[model samples]
Structures are given as C-alpha cells and as structure tokens.
Target: MLQDTFNLMPLWAFVAACGVTLVAGFVKGAIGFAMPLVMISGLSIFLDPLVAVAGIVLPIVMSNLLQVMRFSWAEARAALREFWRYIAVICVMILIAAQFVTMIPTQTFYLVLGVPVVILSLIQLVGVRFHISPAWRRPSEWIVGLISGTIGGLTGTWGPPTVLYLIALDTPKAKQMLVQGVVYGLGSVTLFLGHLQSGVLNGVTAPWSAALLIPAFLGMRLGFWMSDRMNPVLFRRATLVVLVVAGVNLVRRGLMG
Candidate 1:
C-alpha cells in the first residue's frame, strides 16, 4: 500500500519530509497552534498536495489529542460550553462543505481562504484593538464559524480564523490555548472523516501518515521543553507574525496560480 504512494518519492525527499514534520511538531508544541499550517506548507514543498495533506492528518489529530489531554475534563467542558455555537456551525458547515471540495475552483478557493488569514493576522500583529461586541457576538460566531468550517472542510485549515476569534475576545492565555485545542480537536475530527469520504485518506495513505508520527511527536517533546523558557507574550506575537507571513505566501500563490 505504501509502495504505490510514498515510494514514488526519492528516499532523501521522504527524509526531508520527516524533518519538516519534526519542525512542524515543535512549532505546535511551543505555541499550541500552527501544526497544520506548518505541516501542510512545509511538506507540500516536496510532496504532492494530496500526499502532503494525508501525511499530516494522524500527526495533527494526535497533537490535538495531546493538547486536549492537558486540560482537565472540567476545563474542556467549559470550553465546549462557551464556544458551542461556533463549534456547531463549524462542524455542520465543515461536513457539508467538505463534500464539495472537488467542485470548487482551486485558485479562487485559495484566494478566498488566504486573504482572510492574511488580513486577520496582520490586524492582530499590529496590535490593533479588534473586538467583537457582545451584541454581535452570537451572529459573528455563526458567520465566522461558517467561514472557518468551510475552509477547514475544503482545505483542512481552520486555525487562523478561530485564532482571530479567540484573540478578539481577549480570552485569557491558558484558556485560549485550551479553546484552540478544543476547536482544533473538533475540526481535526471532522477533517479526518471528511477526507475519508473524499478519498484523501485511505488504506494506502494510512501508513504514510502513521510513519510520519514519530518525528512529529519527537519534535513536540523538544518544543514543550523549550516553551517553558519563552515569554507568553513573545510567543503569541511571534506566532502572529509567522501567520501573517504564511498568509501572504498563500495569497501570492493564489494570485500567481
């Protein structure tokens, strides 16, 4: 099964993909986010897009599980309670939108997805006071969750928007991390199921994803160790900066393509 897929790549390219997985894992461990962004972007540099997507699934799901485990059940339940509507919108929308991935125009899809990520990350990095008023919060949750779940369904990335939402709320840092985990955890589950239906993750690709888990987990451990020494504010600012840069790259590719 792995032969028809992973064996298509040169041995060294596969090794490099492992390295990329490690780096992506470290980023996630340190920041509690960005693993999917990093994994997909980095792995795509050397592998086919569908292959790259499949490769990251198990690792990302496992990473989010690790994150969810960090919080007690009470904390997880509280996060679910607070963000339930957004979660519902995101989940339902993802299921519906994901089934249509093959029909969406690729370049337009990328632009639609990338532009918002770029804009939101730039606003946050610039220290702008972007906030959602309580009056609009419920409506905004549905709207944002709709957009987020759609992107996640079609592209397997739903992080930036969710991050923007949490940041806008000025959620406490620890709580924010837990919320991210919960949101991402749910999104990842949907992504896994959606892709299974879409045929992106199958018996052949399963081993490749499973094989990549080693480097991802190892890198996460290293990152967790280093995260203790970094300032929280600094880490978040850095994450935003990286997100902006990534968004810009995505936008550029969408335009150029």
Candidate 2:
C-alpha cells in the first residue's frame, strides 16, 4: 500500500505532490526543460529531501522519454551523434557524484539544488546570452556536461545549466528540442540507475516515484496542446519568474535550516 512506502506522508501531502508534478510536467512539455527543477523544489517543501529526490527520478525518465519520442527516431539519433561528448561526460559524472548523495547533509543538499536554479533562472530571465564559437563548442560541451551532471547527481535537477549551454550555442528551436530530449532522456536514466545504487530509489521510494507518472503524463499532454496554440516565449518567461521565486524559497530554506 502507499502507506507502507510513504509511512509518514499523509493523503493531503500526496495530493499536493501530484499537483506539483503535474505543473512541473506542463512546464517541461511547453518549454522542453525545468521539470526536475520544479519538481524537486516543490516536493522538497513537504517530503523528506531524499524521498523528494527519489520521487522525481521515474517521472523525469518517463517524461523525457516522451519528449524524445515526439520527434522522429532519426532526429533523436542525430542529436545524440552531435552531442555525444557532452552526453558521455554527463553520464560519467552523474555516476560518480551520485555516490555522495546519501553522504551530504540536508541543508547542504538544499543549497546545492537552490543556488544554481536561482542563478541560472536569473541569467536567462535577464536576457543574458552566451556565445560559443565554432572552435570552442566541443570543449564547452564537455565542461558544461561535467558541471550539469554533478549537480544533477546530487540534487535531481540540472535543467538550467543544460539549457544555458543550448542557448549559448544559439540552437534553433526544433533542433534544441530534440537535443534536449536526447540529453535529458539519457541523463535521467543515468540518474535513475545511480540513485538505485545510492539507495535513494529503493523499494519504498520507487513506488511513489512511479505513481507520479500519471499526473506528470496528463499535464504534459495538456501542455503539448497549449504549446500548439499559445506563445511559448511569454509562457517561458512566466515560468522562469516562478522558478526564481521557487529557487529563492529553496535558498531561504537552506539558509534558515
């Protein structure tokens, strides 16, 4: 039963968590990023920190899988071929950094998740653009991948940094979506397996993570519908504003804890 897994969580809290995951999935479907940032930040407010991390893993993996399948297999493969270096580095780092998840203190965990979300969301919201020259693209990809993977391993969120890198390259919208899907989809699988070994995604937490997929999937489908009709730019800006607020609250929690 649900009670056996989330022994301390009440029905109301689980309902709220489903709502949060739904919203997070909607944002991700609309913009192609930020699901984990939204989920981890929102769920942390009510769940144990490790439980929150565990909770996002399956939804993230499944959601990104759906994102990838939206495009043709050929497109996904091309994105993977182009970004192999970055993806490889991220997987390696995620596996390594994940080993420390159970070792970090709770307050440190909050800061690890919060500070980067706040900083990266602010950077994008302010319209700061980073340019990566053709010559430097390869190195930049590896570097960004390393950093993104480390943070992702520790906190279950890494969208901002990866998105920043994509923006830096000035990737076209269509290509960017495929690339994000490829990168995030693979990275999320790594996160799932890494957490499994770290004991964060053990039997009890895994069910809770799996159960969230329903709400996450539904919200994503709705977002896909809205994305076809609305202005993504405006919606993305609004989401970033919310992320800043969420990130700030996370930082406050870390500091005050």
Candidate 3:
C-alpha cells in the first residue's frame, strides 16, 4: 500500500518530503511546538494537501508522546490535571471536527489555518502582556481549545492556538513544554484515532505516514540536542518568526488558490 502511494510520486518529491519531515521534527524538538504546522506547510508544497496531512499525523503523535515521557509520571499527571479542562475541549472538539476534514473546501481550510497562526504569532512577537485574571481563564480555555481542535481537524495544524493560550497564562518555559506535550499528546491520540475512523488513515496513507517517522525522530534528536545548548529566549523568538513566515505563505496560497 505504501509502495503504491509512493509510486505515484516522483522519487525526488518523496525524498524531499523526508527531508522536510526531518526539519519539522528538529523544529518541534527545539521549541516543543509547531511540528504539525511545519509538517503540513512543508509537505503541502508537493503532495496533495490531504495526503500531506495524513503523513504528519503519526509523527505528531510519536513526538508528543516522547515529549511527555521526558518528564516523570507525576509531572505528566500534574500537567494533565492543571490543563484537564482545556484538554477535554480539545479532545471532544477535535473528534467532532475531524469528521469534516474532506467536507471543507481546500481554500477555506488554508484560510482558516493560516489566519489565526499569523495573528497569534504576531501578537507574541509584539510582546503584549496578557494578564488573564482567574475569572476569564476557564472560558478562554474552552474557546481557544475549540478553535484549536477545529483547525487541527481541518488542516492538521493546531499548535498556534494552543501556544497562544499557554503564553497568555504566562506558563514558564519548562512547564510549557510539559503542558504542551500533555495537551498535544492527548490531542494527537485523538487525531490518530479520529482520522482512522474518518477514513483519512487507511491502507495507503498509513504506510506513508509511518515511513515519515524515521526523519521525524532523527530531526527531533538533533533539535533536542540543540535545545539543551541554545538560549530559550532566542530559539523561541526564532520559532515565532518561522511561524509568521509560514502563516503568511499559507494565507497567500489560500487567497491565490
């Protein structure tokens, strides 16, 4: 099945996608976010958008799982308890949204995915301080979680919304990675299962998605290595800059297409 899917693509394109996945993994490892955004944006360049999405689903799940495992069980449980409400929102909404993957138009998908990413990244880059009083935090989580899940389902990218929500809460750097892993890890589990039920991850796409895991893991190791050595502030800013660029490109494609 995998051979049949790959056979449809030029050899060069497949090789290129593997490289793209590696870079995506590296970015995820360094930053603890944006893997899905990077994978979909890069792979969508050559592969059919739907196939591009399916290919990255497994990688997202694997990387996120590894992320949580980096922390101990007690830490993981604590993060989950803290963010459980938002996680619930993401899980339920993502499954609901996943059913509509093929139902939405491609142009609309791009627009929906790109616009929020650009806005969120720009907001962060500007250094706006969001003092979320305890009053509005719960409601905000639901709203953001819904948006993230819907976008995740439609375009296979949900990191931006989640990131914005966490930053707004002023979550510290280390906790941020753990929470992101827990939150996104849970979502990835749902995403994988949701897509399976929705017919998005069948015989053909399954093989392709699994195959991309090689580069994803390799790139993530390199990124994890760099994360230990690099300045967090600088690397985070770099991630935002990349997000801005990728988001703008997506917006352009949506408008042009």
Q: Which wins on lDDT, candidate 1 or candidate 2?
A: 2
lDDT string for model 1 (125-238, tens) is: 787776888998999999999989987787677887887888788788889889999998988888888888888788888788888889999988987887889886688688
Q: In lDDT terms, how accurate is model 3? A: 0.86
The TM-score that candidate 3 achieves is: 0.95
Tell me how candidate 2 scores on lDDT: 0.91
Candidate 2 lDDT by residue in tens digits, 45-81 = 9888998999999999989999999999989988999
Model 1 misplaced regions, further than 4 Å: 103-113
Question: Where is model 3 more than 4 Å wrong at Cα?
Answer: none
Of the candidates numbered 2 and 3, which has the greater TM-score value?
A: 2
The most accurate candidate by TM-score is: 2
> For candidate 1, what is the lDDT?
0.81
- CA error at residue 106 for candidate 2, angstroms: 0.9
